[model samples]
Target: MTAVVQAEGLTKYYGRRRGLEDLTLDIQPGEIFGYLGPNGAGKTTTIRLLLDVIRPTRGRVQVLGGDPRDPAVRARIGYLPGELALEGHERARDYLRFLGRVRGGVPASRIEELAERFEADLSVQMGKLSKGNKQKVGLIQAFMHEPEFLILDEPTGGLDPLVQHEFLAMLREVRRSGRTVLMSSHVLAEVESVSDRVGIVRGGRLVAVENVAALREKAVRRMELHFDAPVPAADFEGLAGVRDVRVEGAGVRCTIDGRPDALIKAAARHTVVHMVSAEPDLEEIFLTYYSDEEQHSARQESA
Candidate 1:
């Protein structure tokens, strides 16, 4: 299947500063592709390039199999920018109506339905709405048209937890309807909940892309085991996937990668009294990629 969005050697620069560097990626149709990065990690830069809001300094990008500059292409896409700009005095209903007309008349029923779902008050003027309410309005506009593709940047910003939950449910429905979504966020848990595949970016570079499940599999866990008696450190050594093994007076602590079957069995040999395991957050997993890259660079320099 052709990609919904594609970028090859996609680089962007603002004067002498780098915005994004050689980001090569493909987002498939009918999947929620999470673009994960920190605040200045080029997620917005990539989005703007894809939307033709800014031209890339180098490389090429294709959205919906054509140039992003084309009117028809824009019409088929829904975008909710990270920083929304709303006309302060305009009524929310009037604003959505204007956009609907621009998109060739999104049905009134559809607009009403979306508002109801998001619990958005179209009656309020844009300026008077709270940040969370404004976010709801933004979401209603982006989804009311039901375009073939959606590009959302920090979509859940300022949203209450309940509303955020509702939005994620809406995304699942979009997938079920065969539409594609590109969701960029700094929140790891949000992306992990909805994204089929995630692209991790750091320092204006694409660090890694992997299936969400696979990425979770690579997550590190800190494990501590207490034994009835002191256990020898040598007994835990040479266990596959275990690292930083330390034995300290009836207690053992180590970090484990992937499954803990071997570690569990090894611990069972001793009189296991208690165990405490803590799962690291996705950010830690993401940092491993950067760590590996740094190690590689250092090795090259040494060589």
Candidate 2:
């Protein structure tokens, strides 16, 4: 499949500080690429560079096989900023209509359909709308055009769980239509559900890019299994990608690093009553990369 977005050695700076450095990646067409990182980690910077909102200090970026500065290339892309700036007094419907018109006139019916689906009160002025309502407006505009490539920065911010699910469903729909989505978010679980592949960024650089299933596997999760009969400790001992195995009476417990199949099949050998698996939270995942980046940064600073 052709790449919808490709960046190589993409670098940016703000004064003496780095914004994004040596960033390189390819987002396949019709794929949802999750850009995972904490705040000030250059997620926004990368988006801005892609949109041509700012210039890259170095390297190259191609959107839709053309320069991002090309208006035609930009027309095929949709974007929502991390910080949404909407003025008050203008009704939400009017606000969205204006954006739609600027983007070549989205159908009136389409606009109304999205408004109702998101439960947004378009009659209210943008300024009077609650934070969630304002977000709904943003979503409507970003998605109304149905661009080929979507770059959403914290797209579901300020929205409730239901609204967030709605937004993700919309994203999934976009991908279903064979469009591409690049979602930049720190919300790991949400992204995990929708992303085909996730790129973990830290300190203005891409650290790891792996398929969701693969990444989750790399991050070992603890699992406890209870069986009717005692499991042969030897059956699971030192199994490939299995670690920290312990036997306690009729139960067996272990942490599977990158493969659970082996452990599962072994457990199935016994009469299994129940099993519990707990994946690490974002904080735990964050510290894993953050600390590594911190050490790398420190070494670079010293050098």
Alpha carbon lDDT of each predicted model: 0.91, 0.86
What pairs collide in candidate 2?
A: none
What local lDDT score does residue 216 receive in model 2, on the 0 to 100 scale? 64
Instruction: Name the 10 consecutive residues with the lowest summed lDDT in model 2.
Output: 279-288
Candidate with top lDDT is 1
Per-residue CA lDDT of model 2 for 1-102, tens digit only, reads 668888999999998899999999999998999998889999999999999999999999999899999998888888888888887798888888888888
At residue 119, what lDDT does model 2 achieve? Answer: 91
Top model number, TM-score:
2
Each candidate: RMSD to true structure?
A: 3.1, 2.2
